[model samples]
Structures are given as structure tokens and as C-alpha cells.
Target: MGSNPAAPIEVHDLTVAYRKKPVLWDIDFELPEGRLIGLVGPNGAGKSTLIKAIMGLMPLLSGYVRVYGQPLEDRRELVGYVPQRESVDWDFPVDALDVVTMGRYGRMGLFTRPSKEDYEIAMACLDKVGMADYAKRQISQLSGGQQQRVFLARALTQDASIYLMDEPFAGVDAATEKAIIELLKELKSKQKTVLVVHHDLNTAEEYFDWLMLLNMRLVKFGETRDVFTQENLRMTYGGKLHLLSEAAEKVARQ
Candidate 1:
């Protein structure tokens, strides 16, 4: 394997399965540092599965993932993950600030609590996402877009070099979407790499500098202008292997 020290994320022959059925097969790609990347594919395309595998949240059937030329476990602190907003329990009794402060928990050992400085850092993140005023509001009280911004703020507080966000634009207002794109640009300017799981093909070209096209595997990964063409998108969303389709369907049914 060519280990480029500058690449933020490197996957080699990665495979993941649910039960006995494969979800992602023989996936391999390296994400360049300091770019805003859009990971696009049709539903059930294993986009989120890929992010989950990278975060070690899901078991991998085979293959390995590296972060900054080292095993993922060794550089876990350098990776920040923003899961889908829907995956969270909104009703839990926590304000926006509390949620953001939780990001510091990884840096803070189990026995230590967040200090005043940590709270300041969380507030700064909230301000960066334009949610500083909502710090005291209950998470459930925020609008969909505001909730998403809060999540972004939480991820920002991690101060990670690389970020993996799953569908950050889903269910967000246009204003929130624009804000997120700006935040991504800011991250890129700071030499941080961000990979966003995005579904809207129309906005995909406009938002990202790099693109990762996946359909149960890596279809193409390169600069947006080169990889986001009609042919590659067709290959991603079009005809699938009957057996793989059937397996995915069966897994979904369960």
C-alpha cells in the first residue's frame, strides 16, 4: 500500500457486512488533506456504512483503515465524527452548550470534567456555527437547521484534523446549508479535511472540491470536476448486481 503521509484518510480493501450479507465490498480510497469532500451515492449505497467503519463504530469484515499514515485507533483523537441528527435522542435533557461540551470528553479523561476553559471553547464553536445565542436552549427546542448547526458546533469543538460527517445537510434549511458549506470552506482553509455524506446531486458539484462516488464500493474518487460526471453518477445510481441488491433488500427487511 502506498502510504502518503499527507493523506488524512486511507482505506485499503475494506469490507463490511450486516449479518452474513455484504454492505460494502472491496472499498479502497485515500482522501486528500485540506479539502471539502462530498461522498455521494444512492440510498443503501453504503455511504454511511463507510463512515461508520472508519470511525470503528461498526465491525469490518476485512481490510483496514488508516488515518494520517497510522492505524485509526492510534489517531482516534484526530478524527471527529458527526452522526446523522436523526440518530440522536433529541428529547434528552441537554442544552446546546452541553451537547457541544461533550466533544471535549474525548480529550478529557474519564475522571475529569469539563472546566471553564472547555465551556469557553464550546461557546466559541457555537458562535462559529452561528448558534451562540441558542447555547441555553434545550436541544429539542431548536429547529431542524439549528439542531444541525449545533451538531456541527459539537464536531468543531473536537478540534480534529479530519472530520467525517454523515448527512449534515439532510433536513436542514437553505440558510443552514449555506452556513455549513462556509464552515467547510473555513475548515479547508485551516488545512483540515472534511468528508460529508451528501445526497443531493444538484448541490454536490457546488459544495465540494473533492468527490467520492460510492455504490457498495468505490466507483470513483477524485477532484469534483473530474469524478462528478454523468457517467460515474450513472454507474453509482444505476444497475446493481442482482445478488448484492437482493442481499441489501433482505437485510433492510430484517
Candidate 2:
């Protein structure tokens, strides 16, 4: 809905499903440019599926997704994806820098070796995530938070304009979460767009500017404060949680 010159990621009448069971339906929304938008919902809510469909990782049952006014594949270098921690095997034999270099593979094309410039870019990404010191360490040695940061660094090395993250906070520690938030805010400041799949309701208000509530059926999506109210929360979370949160907020204010 924003009229900004920088085009945002737009999903129009988007629908996605698995085995003919509809997971998302008639989902229409515009993720404004330069904001940290959180996609919140319970398990099986299709939060991850939403990002996957946008990124072209999954087939769309219907509708269309556009990034910065162009389709996803057309701007491959402009889209970065940080999948769930469980998405990859931890025992893989790769160092932090080694992992970051993969981000440049798209620009370098397939089966080609990384040039010196690629290594420089990867190191810069490591520095961005505060993992420059751990560049030599194997990924398996990292804590959950550190591992997520490494993945973030990988995405950053790609210099993408749009970021789609699936539950980046799931297993990370509080400290790491804070660090990641700081990094994301920096990205927003640079006019890059970030959409995260999140679950912690307590911190949802503080973490995002826009909120998309999904229950495998496109419950809601809009400005965070507007859509995260008690009425919408009930529809998104449940009636009991709405009552509890309302009471808690009233008590805190009193």
C-alpha cells in the first residue's frame, strides 16, 4: 500500500498447498520497503511455506509473487534466504568462510572456483555477523545462535536486496537474538527488506514493524500495532491468549 519509490515484495492472491491440501489461500499483501516484518503463527501455520513459495523453492498453487517489481528468479542475486536451523545437517565439513563463499556461487556460476574477490566478500560478511574470529572453525562447533549468525553471514555475502528468513530465532540464545536483531535493523536502515517467520508472541511487538498472522489460511497481515491487537490476536493465536494478553497488559500499565 506504500507509495514509496523503492518497490517492495508483493504477493497478490497467492495460494500454496501440499498434496492438494491448501496451506495458504488468497493471500494478498504488500511488504513495504525497508522494514523488518515478522510473519507469526503457530506450528503448521504455513509461515515457512509462505517464504518458500515467494522464493520459488515451492510450487505455487495459484497467484503471483514479485520482488522489487520483478519476479524472484529474475533477480536471483537480490534475494537471500536463511532457512530453518534444522534444514541442514550440522555435521557437514565446512568452515565459516567456506560457507560464506557459497553465496557468491550464483554470481560465479556453477563448477567454477571462487576467486580472490569472492574470499574478500565472504570475509566481509563474516565481519558483519561478528564471526570473523570463527572463520576457521567448523560449523558443527557453533552454538545454535552462532550457527544462525553464520547462515545470516552467508546470506549477507550475497548482497541481496530482499531477505526471507524462516524462524531465524528458533534455537538462538537471547544474546544472539539481540545481535541478529541489531544486524537486521542495520539492513533495514540500508533500505533492504527483511521478512522473518517468528513464533514468540511476547517479543513480536518489539521485533517487527509489520505483522503477518497465518494459520495455514492467511489470518491477517498489516502494520504490527494495527494487526497485533487483541481482536486480531485472538483470531491468529486463540481466544484464551487474547484474554490473557489483554489482562497482562492492563496489569502492567496499572
Candidate 3:
């Protein structure tokens, strides 16, 4: 599950496949509703696949995903998604504000234009992410971190209770990562649930309250402090090591 029902996103027995090959298997967990949760794993471990399946971005082999106690698709407004920075073209013509306004497109309903209120909400979301000054700037001109912030602002504009972010910190500098972490903390303060697909091992404990460790299957899901241990880290990133360490990594990095 993504987060608590009282909190934000939830998933049960989530299984996903790519081209008939299973990528995720029987993942079940509850995020602490309004807190930040981190999804950590090796490459090809299906971290991004988990969020995508939950978001209906692709079909799920089995399992369920809910936002605010309802199926996500039925209650789309209660959810927001920030895809990877590499997921889209930076050269696209859309400006920062224009991206944020997409959040309201759903609320505006099909075949209609945005209203004045939509603009206000989009501006507010941009401001929330500290990008109001660059609302009109083309995305290509921004740095990696700024671009990430803009994407986050777009998600915020949706005003959803749950946020699913894929590799939010992938290409950003430390300063940008810190800034984004701070913004996530602020979202927690507002009782919004956030799930981030994170790869950096160094900042795991410091940045997230909950962790979903995966490798094409649910390895472990619980409090970051309890679940993040020497043995687990060994299992999670051991392949990078040698001998016994490498073997453990093999079992974990399914």
C-alpha cells in the first residue's frame, strides 16, 4: 500500500508484469498516511514499476491500489503523481506554470478551458514549491533541481491527498535534494502522504520515515529505523560488494 487511508495511498498484494514477465510480486504495505515513504532497490528491481502500476499508468497483473479509501481511478483528484525528470522531454514548449495547470485539467473536466480559479491554484502550487518567480520560464532553462521542484509544484496544484514520485532526486544536486526533502516534510505537516522512489543509499534514514525495500518483489516494508539495518543494507546493495556480500545481493536484488 502507498500510505494510510487516513493518511493518503494504500496498496495490497500489488503485482505487476512487463511483457508477460513479472516485475513486481505480491507487495503489501501501508505508508503512514501523511508521512514521506521511500521506495529503495537496485536497478531492474521494479521501484518505478510499482508506482506506475498503482497509478494505472500501466496494467496490473493483480492487487489493489487505493487513494483516500477509494480506487485511485475513481478518485483521481485525491492523488497526484510526479514522474521522473527523464520521463518527459525538457525541450517541450510548456512553461513551469503551464505544467502545473495540467493538474487542474482533470478538475476542469473534459473538453473545456481553465477558469480564473484554476490559475490561482496553479500559482499557489508553484509558490508552495518556491517556483513562483519562474512560473513562466521554459522548463529547459531550469537546472535539474529546479525542474524537479517545478514537477512537484505541478503535483501540488492537483491538491491531492496522496503523492507518488518516481526518482525525485535522481539528477539533482545535494542542495536541490535537500530542498525537495524539506518540501516533502512540509507536505507531511499538511498531512499529505508522499511516496518517493529513491536510489541514494546515504540519505535513506535521514529523509524518510517509512521505507519500502524491493527487488521485483516486496523484500521488506516497515519503519525506516527498524527495517533499515546492516543486514538489510547488505542485502539491498550487496551486489556492489564481493563474495558473501555479492551473494546476498543476488538473493535480494531479484
RMSD of each: 5.2, 3.6, 4.3
TM-scores of the models, in the order given: 0.92, 0.91, 0.88
Q: Lowest lDDT 10-mer window, candidate 1?
A: 243-252
lDDT of 1 by residue, 1-254 (tens): 26686579998899999999999999988888788999998889899999999999999999999998899989988999999999989999999999999998989877999999999999999999999999999999999999999999999999999999999998888789889989998999999999999977777898999999998989999999999776777788765556435644664454
Best by TM-score: 1
The parts of candidate 1 lying over 4 Å away from their true place are 239-254
Model 3, 90-145: lDDT tens digits are 99998988888888898875778988888899999888777889999999999999
Error of 1 at 153 (Å): 0.3
Which one is best on lDDT?
Answer: 1
Clashing residue pairs in candidate 2 are: none
Locate the minimum summed-lDDT window of 10 residues in model 3. 243-252
Q: Give Cα-based local distance difference scores for all models.
A: 0.90, 0.85, 0.82
